[model samples]
Target: MESALLLAPKLVSNPSREFRSNVRQFQSSFCGKSIAIVEFTRTDAYTNHKSISKITSLFSLGKKKVKTIKRETVIPDPDYRIPIVLLGFAGGLVYGDNLLAAAPVGLLGLLLLFQTTRVKFVFDDEALEVKVGEELDESGENVFVGGKNRWKYSSFVNWELWWPNFPILVYFKETQTKPEGQIHFFPVIFNGKQLYDVMVERAGPSKTSGPN
Candidate 1:
């Protein structure tokens, strides 16, 4: 379904010499198709995960020895959805150099696209790894690619979690100098129940009074 929708644009006749325009059209089609795929895959993954979890629980009912099972939760970074939609909408507005409509749309779309770059959060026993532009493996493990921002359990201090609209502010005591201290702001959007608990457990106690 998504492939057909994406390729459907190729059938539209373009009698213009502007190669950039054609590229933009192609990209817009790609983004639109991606949104469709993300929505479908998200729903499918959730359903499959639930079914698999039930089966696993039933199979593991009568285990002999006691063991500690590490929990893993995969949360899709949904920041890209809005930007991709905006860009696709902008591409729709572009009708052969119609700057009046296209210019603002294109600029706004560019900004949104910048914000929409893929990001995923992987939480495990040792560290909280942030994987950008990568997904999970077949066994539901984070595919450790090149770009990964990992925060070890002992990396930050002053674990302050704020209200409804706030980011997790943690101080990197390791980076603190005699004059000033370094603070890192992690957006709360990537946070979940398990992830939060793991972070707190790893971080232990807050050393500093505040982000100061």
Candidate 2:
């Protein structure tokens, strides 16, 4: 006898008051009323995680006021048949019921705390499953995938260590230039040196040109 399989699409809920409330609370406390989102540049000839962190420290981290930055990036598929990609930044999923804001914030003390490290990676193709690694552990890396190409988890050492670096309060200019604030996260799938090596190798090469 053959068995029949019932296939149903995964369900996603609408935005919620709880999230809006959190957003309100976040906005009031965080200082994010405008467009956030830092420009995550692939490590340049003169920069590395440490240098980037240094630059970040100078801006929002300076005055000690937090900002809530939200960002959305849409990846277009050349095949049009492939669904357009939508990536919601930290604290966003909560609003849309896609993820719980409470869990992350309770532990990390506001998503903005890990701005450089906070990211919501999204894969829209029905055929794509994000390859989803073996097991997810506790770290600030998963949510952002910062190391792989250019993402949140890419620049963090440990969420704990990265926390203080996030700007508590940030201000945005109407012009929409530069990141005012960001989201934060901890380990979700991969961990430790494995994560580090992946980023470094993909980063191509160190700016230092030396002997063969």
Best by TM-score: 1
> Candidate 2 lDDT, tens digit per residue, 59-97?
123355668664333221111110111123334556767
User: Local distance difference test, per candidate?
Assistant: 0.46, 0.27
Question: Candidate 2 — what's its lDDT?
Answer: 0.27
Measured against the true structure, the TM-scores of the candidates, in listed sequence, are 0.35, 0.17
Across 150-190, the per-residue lDDT of candidate 1 in tens digits comes to 55554554555543233332233422221243355544434
Candidate 1, which ten residues in sequence have the lowest lDDT sum?
A: 50-59
Cα RMSD, each candidate: 33.0, 37.0
Reference-based TM-score, model 1: 0.35
